[model samples]
Target: MRHDSATLIILLAVVALIAWFAPDVVLIVFAGCLLAVALRAPGVPLARRLGIAEHWGVMIVALVALVALGLLVWFGFATLADQAREFSRAVPRVLERAGTLLEGLPGGDWLKGQAQPEAVQPSARAAANFALAGVSGTLGALGNALLVLLLGLYIGADPTLYRRGALALLSPGLRPRGEATLNAMAHSLRGWLLGQMFGMAFTGVFTFLGLWALGVPLAALLAILTAIFGFMPYIGPVIGAVPAVLIAASHDTSLVPWVIALFFASQNIEGNFLTPMVQKQSSDVPPALLLGAQALFGTGLGFLGILLAAPIAAAGMAALRVSYVEGWVEDPADTDEKRIIRPA
Candidate 1:
């Protein structure tokens, strides 16, 4: 018993050290797990219907998704390409207009000074370094994305293999509880993903309609961006709103407030209405906990950290409930009335 405990502690310590030293790898793995869950969500049902293996279903789903994405790009590429170019052109204009507007306000000169690039030009060496860094960053991002997709596909193909491998790490006595905790975590993650998808769809549709109504250019592009960004909670919506607000401000100063109001309304509806409705069927991760996790992970891991924070928090909460709360805190002997009664 003592040997098992010691082994578990050492294992945990080794895992923690790896996480601390190589957070990027950890983030990539977590992202792959998330993608696997997403693939499995549809794949499982399809497998049952088609009387095929789950892994085969997952493969089929992945192939179909890739084909659909290719078709979408083939069809929508021209319009999106045009809008993207227009968006790029509009950004500089927006910044210039913003600088002008800032100059008109009190303390605007100081703000503009702070906001603008430094007057001093960079040296050749510095310029080269900056360009190198940008290229490296872009390449690194693409590499990481490809790795994530491959890992996700591999894991989604045979999730049970990974599950059993994980269980193998635990003692025989603890494997059942560990498996239960893992299942709970998976359930929580799935729920969070489902809720996020719904929220993103809701935000996208409403944003496009509202932007179109308000005569915003690149409504489709902006809406797609907003939907994509909606995956990250708290900070995402705000970031998503920035391009639209900037474009609106540049186009017609009057449109800015309306654009802001539109996003505010959409976010409120999604947060207050859609999210709660979905949370009813899943574990409810507290807003404070989620925000705290975002802060911690974002500080440590940057953008990917923020993107995965909510689902991590959800899974963490689920694991706690199963392993700690239900395992020890709840008294099987106590009746509902007894549980509710406070000590005098």
Candidate 2:
């Protein structure tokens, strides 16, 4: 199909504005849809047990999931807020320990003389701030999140509506292949969500266990950080571990280096084995391309782009397979991809 220049420009501008205005909402909606996909299987059992219709059953589960998520956030934030207060009071000791440990490194002599970077202590701007940050975050954005939450419910409870609506809007010649693409895309998204949650739980448990064993303070709060960061796929390991290292550094100067190194080691293990293996059972997305997309579109879409990258790629894979392999369209340059579809 020939692309329209004006139309393309308009679309790009709209997308850019949306990305700028509401990145968080978009990612939340994407996440909610993914969660719905993951839970679709259990809807059947839930419906039977609750004596509700399929759609209602799905909504029930979705709300329950959202509520549970909210409660988890509430508790986690509360815990972190408490930790921050305690940590702030103990900042001098932590800084002294960190400086002592840093002095042993290659640049130790110069570093120990200087002050700890405020960077290590999360500033008001950083998300690691106290629950007090939530009020700032919600200022005018609460409505957007609520809208996305509602949209997610409608889409999740009966995704087929959107699929059919989208399929109907496609060119007649492309509808059959598009349907196939949607099916595959949904499956891949569902699998990715399942794998993601599983990976998060695994990471959280491992981090908590490691920190607790090492006697790190605020182990629960640190585990939550690990799990939340793990949402970003390959980038999560480092993001999750940074605070833990700093917090640990603050506690015992001698243990800082070991703690940092161990965090990296655990991340390596999870990336190389746990996450990939679980995700592989769901779908096969190459790590190189995943990271590349994260870097590229992430610049354009920020966190929303990063979160949606894998799902979009999964959809593209489905389209390519159904269009070329299933013979829905002809690839003029490659005879191998010529596909014929007969109307029913």
TM-score of each: 0.90, 0.73
Off-target runs (Cα >4 Å) in candidate 2 are: 1-32, 39-41, 48-51, 70-80, 90-136, 261-265, 324-344
lDDT tens readout by residue for model 2, 271-303: 677766766754667778778878876887776
Question: How do the residues 235-323 of candidate 1 rate in per-residue lDDT, one tens digit apiece?
Answer: 79999999999899889999999999999999999988897797665758777888999999999889889988888888888877765
Q: How many pairs of residues in model 1 come into backbone collision? A: 0
- TM-score of predicted model 2? 0.73
Candidates' C-alpha lDDT? 0.84, 0.69
Using TM-score, give the best candidate's number. Answer: 1
True-structure Cα RMSD, model 2: 5.8
